[model samples]
Target: MDKKLIGAIMAFSLAGSLLFSGCSSKNQNTGEQTAEESMIQDVESEVTLGEYKGLPVTVEKLPDVTDDEVTDAVMAAVENASVTGEITDRAVASGDTVNVDYTGYMDGEEIPESSVEDYNILIGSGVFFNGAESSLIGVMPGETANISVTYPEGYPQEDLVGKNAVYQVTVNYIVSEEQAELTDEFVSQISDCQTVDEYRQMVREALETSRENEREQNRRNAVWDKVLENAQVVAYNSGEVQEIVDQYTSYDQSAARDFEMSLEDYVQTYQGVTMDEYTAAIEDIAKQEIKERLVIDAIAQAENINGDNATDEEIQKCSQQQGYDAVDAYKQDRGSDGMAEDVKGLRVVDFVVDSAQITEE
Candidate 1:
């Protein structure tokens, strides 16, 4: 099995719990087939769960989905459903989209990169230099003015850092974003609803669904953490640690390439750490991940929680029903044996969640 696949599955398994991310932010998995969905599918081989009872688990403050949240999401979606409209008389303002032609000069030399023709920009969008958008305030259409601003010292472009530049800017017209009305026509654009009320209901239900998912994930994490606390290991191996480290390094390098940055620079800029520090962080994460894998595997074996134990023909039918093109295709993409093992882990999680003594606060 691919080590990256194992890591990806681990991430998927714990994404909703937000245990591995170590950040206060939430992880929203939006994909055609989320990692959790793929792994939760039925297995073709027999599997088992281990002893997972009487674990003392505590979950605090279950998630709540409110009407205000739904309304906010709907309003934001409406704002994004834009229509082009001309600003007749008013000067440019924040949130207003406007077209302009501009040329910049620094130290008596024209900055070619700072020049744009018939460019459309959103004021206060931070797409331009600091103070550039604010300087455009009160500038009427078809008017020309010279605006000056200084680039910050730590600007990514070393040549432009701490330098003052003057721009000769002209406002063509504002292509203002006119929000769509809460009408049947507008609602149909974003959903299968025929009315505003139905659309709002759908939005509310979606928020509730998300909240429910979060609540369930929190409960499961609490149970798993309890099991870990009392877990006893007679023996273990560090053989998979190297594979995990290699996978982590490769993932970081790929992200650095996507950002068009060197690995060291990417670490410093995004992770706020040196390359060595980032490596040590990932190594620590790998250790924790491997430990969890071993514990889950041991539990799976002890409980005998076989998921499906279906024949090849049955597996093919199950795969097709789960939206796979074919059994062979699913196996090729997500190694059949690996997926089966993951399913067993999920079964153990289910059993633990069901049997644990939970307290909600």
Candidate 2:
């Protein structure tokens, strides 16, 4: 299934936001409060959509779940698929597993904390720099060998970058891997199924359900795209766009914190974009998102579709289920009106999907 369409549907249909961690300020002027409050309180009445109806859309054909696909899916769930082989006397070779004691040295001095006993390394795994794994090839058990290699420039460790290092390596033992066979016992261990045939059937049914879901999402995506293409935006509020921009900014700052770098450094180093460039790009994304919301709102109004019918009791129960002690706290974090907006958008999308003329290929 296409992740973009799945993400779009989830974003519009859900009430929570990953980017925006803060809620809009409460409006004081509007004494006559309405049920449908736009996300941005100040710009609630500033942006409006003109019309949305009878949009042309074509849905693609649903993907088929082949026998090979079902087999692959079932095999992926098999427990203890690989087993270590009996100890072998064969020389260290590619694909062979070995245990060894190693000590690394740099500039003729043993590096502190660079020695390990009974360490495991898979031959030809490319887990180390040049010649580290290849140097162990053809070495017999209990044999000691020396491997010398230079760390490449721009290595993750600042001090070790471009440094020549030597390792005193010893081969402990070699072992091969044996794959587990497919049997009733294996099926019972991995899944609820008791037999291989039963497991295969279960995989087929699961694949069918997944395919149907993807087809439904594709239909919704087609409907939404066509609706957006035909919809007209009579006016747009800059404040609304800025609200979304703030979300992007907050998310970026959070990500930068995770990377142990300032937002500016993170953007320049990882993204190759300056803060100004990122802000401009984020503004465009925010505007596009706002436009989609406006279109969904217009369609909801046109079709007389409303999903914000949850009672106060229902809201309280939902809040409790979400681990909030009080409904007010839940409303504050998720926005009191966000649920209504999500419900309305979902209803509008449902109408679009139900009414769309799907042309399958």
lDDT of 1 by residue, 178-270 (tens): 767777888887789999899999999988988886777678777776665455433323445556667767766787899999988977886
TM-scores, one per candidate: 0.56, 0.55
Determine which window of 10 residues in candidate 1 has minimal summed lDDT: 16-25
- After superposition on all CA atoms, how large is the RMSD of candidate 2? 11.2
Relative to the unseen true structure, what is the C-alpha lDDT of residue 237 in candidate 1, on a scale of 0 to 100? 36
TM-score quality measure for candidate 1: 0.56
Residues 177-204 of candidate 2: C-alpha lDDT, one tens digit per residue: 7676788977787778998999899989
Give candidate 1's error at residue 219 in angstroms. Answer: 0.6
- The list of candidate 2 runs beyond 4 A from truth reads 1-52, 79-178, 272-276, 310-336
The residue ranges of model 1 lying beyond 4 angstroms of the native Cα positions read 1-51, 84-177, 233-236, 254-262, 307-331
